[model samples]
Target: MTIAMGEKIFHHQLVYNDYAKLSRNFFNLGSLLEKIFKTTFLSKSGTQEGENTYMGNTGNKEIDVQGIFSSLPNVPTALFQSQCVVWKDEILICGGRPHNHHCYSYHTTKRKYKKICEYPHTIRIFGHVVVKCESDNNELTLLSFGGVDVSKYTLLMSYQSVWEKSRRKEKKKNEWRVVHHDTSFGTRKSNLTGASALIGGKNKDLLFVTYFPNKIDVIDMKTYHYVCGTGSNRLPIKSPYSLQNHCFVPLTSSNQTVVNHFLLIHKNLSLLIKYNEEDKKFCYESLPTCPSLATCDCYGFISFNDQIFFFGGYDASAMTEIDYIFIYAMKDRAWTQSKHSLPIPTRGCCPVLIGDGRFLHLVGGLAHHRTQAMHLATTVRAFDQVCFFFFFLSVIHLVII
Candidate 1:
């Protein structure tokens, strides 16, 4: 059974699958309610305003609004497979599909966008990775590398003190500096269309790049050189299977020992990659399968507390997009379907955590209809504020039965 109210949809099957095993013993009601209260209200830091800030009910009608989905300003252009990184108070959107080269900086507080710079004229923008790295002098730099472009080298563009200049109306043209054009890294096309990149290492000076099938590349941020040699920059562990449209998210845990761990997800398969600092090597461990894997693809994910939330994606078997949001708890090794969903079926949209990690800002992608081959470009921005308190209320109602 399904219920639709306003823009939200609730699936009875999902709720039943999760709560069907609950006992009907009324004596256990107190313990059950205690569990629900702790899980819904308390955050990882044991504070009411931390990671689970959105879940609290302050009794203020104006401030208590939760799980609300609203539209924001449209992007200057339709884009997907783009790269976004949070830089200070602004979000730098760079390199997307349709051979786009333009880059823009969206100010979070001002809610406005300013065209900053463009990718190199000779490079293709689609499927690229843009990340903030520190220079040798401890200055911040934006490093872009690995895309559909068959370029054999990586590029770096420094934006140090440029934001202040732009504010003062004295902006200067941004230039790309070729960091590594060495042909010795091989002439074979480095087409990392659906890859993931993150900054890691003991000193946080290493860039870890992972591409489809099974390949990992490590680069020294300061020197802008690819790390090579025995026990080299590449990880020796190999996967028995292949994955596409995957995502790598750093594990969010209170334990300090797991700080160097990352969770890699693709469909139902989830792997835990641990960075062994002693040997400077990485290893992987398989985790429980994701429940929504059978119907989710190209989804965006972000970790909070001990749970990972998956946003909209496509269902290849049905050839349709999905608005369902699924949550996987790392502690319980279980999945729960979110009662709230996106306003529309969306795919390939970038999911960004904003405002104390309570709200999710979804950028450009594609919106799909029920029928196949009918889709529209998602130019308008969407915001998803996750407040699962309503789901808790429904569970309470069921307990009364």
Candidate 2:
């Protein structure tokens, strides 16, 4: 908060701005990509696990980072809770923080979110649970895990991202996976935190899981193993990728992605961790022995491309980081910003992404200022790009005269 520190912070931000422009410039971008691929840090410490980007251009240009999604009238709806995810072609939403008993889904085509599912009990536990639907072979599933509920302590571990997998494979026969950890939200199973996974299987095949205290485990229908996270000891306050909060649409892929590859966001640092499934060993299985505070929660999500894509958090100097979406080109080991800006100051709520690599759909989340109580936004923003050509020279002879 000092003048000298403020000046240093301003300089740091200005540097990032210059870097973003350089990374985005069309002429320099190619050379920049080359530099990214040859990054020295990548050679020494490589990150080829979860949430990798597709550097290979699909001929289709990247999404247009423009003022499109921010303008829609976010029509007021019933007091909702938690976040929303696409379910059976419907948007299924859960309540969070303060308890609420309404589990609903909205019909986009019809423009009305109706009641589809509901929690069996009240207390409206804040699972902060629920994620976008995933596919397994032919069966589509929603990998349901952690939430916050102190009432279910007797049933299972008290602090855990409860493990469950519901089938979104068949809409007609939609099924819910059994609650593995008896209590919906608690420690025995969760270790004072919750868990979610990137379902990167041919058909919901694998889950790269980050535990509360410490440890990132990989789970499937049959087997389980520690992929990446902490080894055996408990992580410090604010587990990996966990904090006082958590979701964003994981960059789910059918390609060679894994269940162990994940990034942990906390209040200060955004830890980017990856797993080597091929190198399964006692020492390798565990994260390079790190300090307790090393795993502390530093709020903000790392973008799919390793850009450390951040939104609003609890800091003013870091406020300079606000409104900017930087692309940390993993291939080059550098950061760049998009031509676009965040729709709003996304302090709370989930930045969960939902799409097939091509289109990124940003959905509901909580965004409140220092003065405001709280507000939920259901405005679904979709990102993609389009190339058009036009000429504006339709003039008559009178104009020339």
Candidate 3:
């Protein structure tokens, strides 16, 4: 019912531009008017009329106009070195510092967040690992492990599932239950926050917690007991592979009785270690070094589209943030850098793959701004790499050219 004067003018200009082909002067005026219209209202961050380049070399790239900082909702707190896990359609945000035990869950479909129950402990975890676990009863749970507890030891907490058959509630609240705690694998000995995951086992799932300086502990889910001894003595493999601050991912290529193989990524070494049941030994394969940097020290990685995407970490010497995004194609055994960078320089950020793995949603982390000191970043960014319509249009325009 009410239209602004600028809206009326824009409508008139659009109508005139549709008929501009009738005259030369009209075409020139219409083109000028269109430029004015775009500059006045349609302009956004990282959008240019010509080609744009950021970093990496993943073909013809453009700044994701819709994937800017303003497009995402801010986290409740500016958190870095926090734990993030994707459960079904929701994302769980766990403990982090400046020392607090608050937790949150973000509903991806609703695009809203709700503060969930806090962690069982009062202290904060420095570098924690959180994972989603499912049981044989078809129930889902969350397991959190590792991280420095300061005066206290490292703690292992699992969500107490309330999946009662008689209770017919659509939504249920879960609480963190202390499953295991020990001094040997705790904070005094190691700040065990390297890489972790819940792999499928014979009767239940097994959680593999990797400690610093190359050590792993396998915990049985059903009993919440260590499969072997505590600390470094519990690890299955005695190889000299020191899995310092690295990322551990499991690969399941077969449906056989044996469990999945483990992939470890430390500096200069990308090894795929699998357990040989018959020989009772661990087999390790050295993968090709994909890029020049040859490592992702404090970076984050997630398996997407059958590939591993490594992004967001800081360079140690200069203490500067990194914007490099690399992708390792599993089948092709090759690596390619993406031509786009983060919205800003970031480290300790969590990259979660959503919906068919075309878009990567980067969560909270530490960022360095030119005007201020390094601080926890509250901004979120989405990277849209699948240029479906743009690619088709560009191909058609190229043939015409």
Candidate 4:
């Protein structure tokens, strides 16, 4: 290549005052964390993997499996989002299912957990959501919204069921309030996939949710007034889409809250979609395929260091093991493997972004009951052991490869 006379310029790597500082600042390095970030990966049957994959902090602490249905010998579990968020030095986990109701906070530094408050449901089954509420002090308020009533035995109900249930419980009345303003847009059947973001709108932090049925909606959060639709002419489907799994991440064109771009993680296909909000449509980009990974069954995502991280979900073939975490870098427009693995085999568990920048945490999902017969915390255990054993064998083909 020839340069054009005196107008030519030589290109060189731009030098910064401190290479180490810039390197550390631009990438996610887990070396700074002070606690053990470990979780168990259970096949639907809850059997321990012959070899445990060590996770954050390297597996050297006590696990707080207290009061949970863990004593069951073998039980089928639900596939739902678990929000295990960390703020500063504390980790907070909120609502999931059966006995997974109520919200709790943990001190990573202390390595202990304490229940902060009961979530809207006592016998909570599903459909709990969390979002940044417009509080004066910036205290995050988790929304205890509608969910499936295992008791309903009839058809799935509308979004209003959440408001009705909360009213009856009347617990956390001071801390929790109704999103009374927006429920007026008629009943929506969307159970949310991930947490809603309080993104910048006419105001700095309006709430946005990726409802399960394949659509997006925004609410004033404070006023509970419908702000508008996001990313396209049609909204994504609402949650529990017995048909599809959907995920969303609000991207930036300017400051972080800028809504011109969105990162959508397809619920089950292991595809990450980029939507251009200004053009009012999704971009025509092929999804990066993780042959060993399946997106069709993932729980959540975390974006850090210019790449979005996808963690545990069921293996691609319905009958495979649910035991790994995958990472995809945006610069290369492809997916790769993460050095991390779930503490145990897990499917239908929730993955949440913790602290900020690079830290993330994983919590409860349905796991199988452990059994050796020779060794039982007791004999007549709970859940179902036979179903779980078959569930494990079904997925062995996928994992062996």
Candidate 5:
């Protein structure tokens, strides 16, 4: 590097040009930036040179299991992208790729997995969204929507079928009956993953479903009416391909109005889109590029105490599961990398919050070889309790390290 002052010139070595110095600089910059920006700027999942390393405690809270040794007892075949829903005392694990309609139930009390009676006729079960919806009458139902049949490469029926517990005299209490199969609505796009969520609003609940390239199907949960359309091509940013395994989650806040807002996350994008009830248009917030999250897909996401937690997903460079964990505090509108992480590297797993948002039940997904279902609870104090001055000290410690 050279600097000139009139006729006098001085030459110096730029620190960034040196590979060894650059890596150290990045760590320092990343730590400082994390304190200010509140989000991770460098991904810690991959082991490549220059990537962030674990300098602090590399341990996490120990996981608790009730059933057999490492797994949920009698957990069926190892499946990826299987949808797990919290229903009463059991967690329902349903449909995944290679197309099977059998739904399994994991009894929390019995500590075992049992097959349910209802078998879906739909063939396109891969990469679909299965949501639990409750009606005013206290009727609980599980809805299965758009997915692709990988073998045939064909889009299954978009009209969802609602699986409800049978109340009939002859039917078993645990048996699920497909009561309503609405054929009016259907989405052409298929092979979509993590592109759907059942959002709750002040007036009524709504379902937001996304399609490949750029298409969204917004359905009013109460009336089953939907608005299906693609975004304008002239928009500043483009929607990622839905088939690529992006995760979409609704931000539930008391501050949110009758309209709903959601966060869309993918390997390359982090977007916050809001639904305008009046204009029926979607608005995007201008946000900085999400650091490590912008580079990987199939991460597990869950919202607890108004904060969003993203953890454990596949590392593209290594082509293996990662144990990274990141937290986004909604009140501060900031992100924080956590020293705490999953016991095992995992992806495609569903996080279920239990015991009044204290314990997290991680349902089965692909771990090293389809991890056994496990429970996680913070052994430390609540995050809000230590978020005051202690937060700054922790950030400073990372910078010093």
Candidate 6:
């Protein structure tokens, strides 16, 4: 008999053995049935090579087994502490450790990468932050700040020019230009290393920068100057220690109490910072402690569907890499660990969400190792959140057989 489910066709055959033989194996019915079901499911599922399916329960919900992780093509070189920004259908990957200057754009649909442009001779690209800001004219600009050298220069590149340069159609000598040579926050020089930048404000003209030792700075994008007259740029509530290798993700909430809000994530802290339009200052409220706070750092962090997902990271105390996937639900303010982990433990990888928030692409990072600095990773893995209908089909088939 032939059965069709979606685009896949499955053929099944039933064989009848002698009644005497069946009676002799009556006590083995459970084992015999298990074997039959396993064979039937594996043959009909049509799982491809290098792909894996997992079945289990996560708390009250049944884990999405179809939403599995699979490897993609390796990047051109192994990289760690790199930065990536999604632009249209491509992910533009910038510099990483080992003094890398080359940048490439990974085509999400084609699953290939093409070298885009190299950083200027003066800039060190690793540990930098890249953000996409759209101007009033609807033109997109890519802004880069901070790096390993703790450079004070801010770089800006035209998105259109970058695309044209990638196609070899532009004749410009340098694609990136130095926008500000002495960018600073109040009395202190900007610490670009391990810093994070986000575009905010009602007009989207303000750039919020969160940097080391718990400091926040707002820069006017139009004039490229730090706003200081309204209030001090530093966070009113300071962390116990300096924050390095931290990240800032904008929070989306239905609450109307604040004009702008963001979540600051670190190894040991999670704080909610809100902008007060009336006071022209930023205030913060501490959230629950991170579940993997003691064991993870330099991991992949992203916000999707009101949830924060943390990928693999290095455990400094244990001196080993971790492969656990931790997720925090924003609505419930609770953390749940996913049964699924990376194919291999990695740290400092770039995570990009594409295609309707269902496909998460994890780019290069440092693989599992004892040393803290070496061993750049080259693998790219993707987690596909397959539809629940597909999982329903598999359950139905198992019950019917």
lDDT of all predictions? 0.58, 0.35, 0.52, 0.41, 0.53, 0.62
**Per-prediction TM-score:** 0.68, 0.51, 0.65, 0.56, 0.64, 0.72
Off by over 4 Å in 6: 1-67, 135-139, 148-150, 161-174, 181-190, 236-240, 254-259, 370-401
For candidate 5, write residues 21-107 as lDDT tens digits: 544454355344333322222122232433222211113433332111122243465455667776555667775543545677766
Model 6: per-residue Cα lDDT over 308-386, one tens digit each: 7888887877777787888776777877776568655667777887665545667776663311221111111222112
Candidate 2 segments exceeding 4 Å error: 1-66, 71-81, 87-89, 122-124, 131-140, 147-195, 200-206, 220-259, 267-309, 316-324, 352-359, 369-401
Q: Which ten residues in a row have the lowest lDDT in candidate 6?
A: 370-379
lDDT of 2 by residue, 247-269 (tens): 22233233333344444444443
RMSD of each: 11.6, 15.0, 12.5, 15.0, 13.3, 11.0
Q: What C-alpha lDDT does candidate 5 achieve relative to the native structure?
A: 0.53
The candidate, 2 or 6, that scores higher on TM-score is: 6
Quote the positional error of residue 91 for candidate 2 in Å.
Answer: 3.3
Model 5 regions lying over 4 Å from their true place: 1-74, 97-100, 135-138, 149-186, 189-194, 228-243, 254-258, 369-401
Clashing pairs in 3: none
Backbone-clash count (model 3): 0
Off by over 4 Å in 4: 1-80, 122-127, 135-138, 148-174, 181-202, 228-245, 252-258, 267-289, 352-359, 369-401
Compute the lDDT of residue 114 as modeled in candidate 2.
48
Better of 3 and 5 by lDDT: 5
Q: For candidate 3, give the lDDT of residue 25.
A: 48
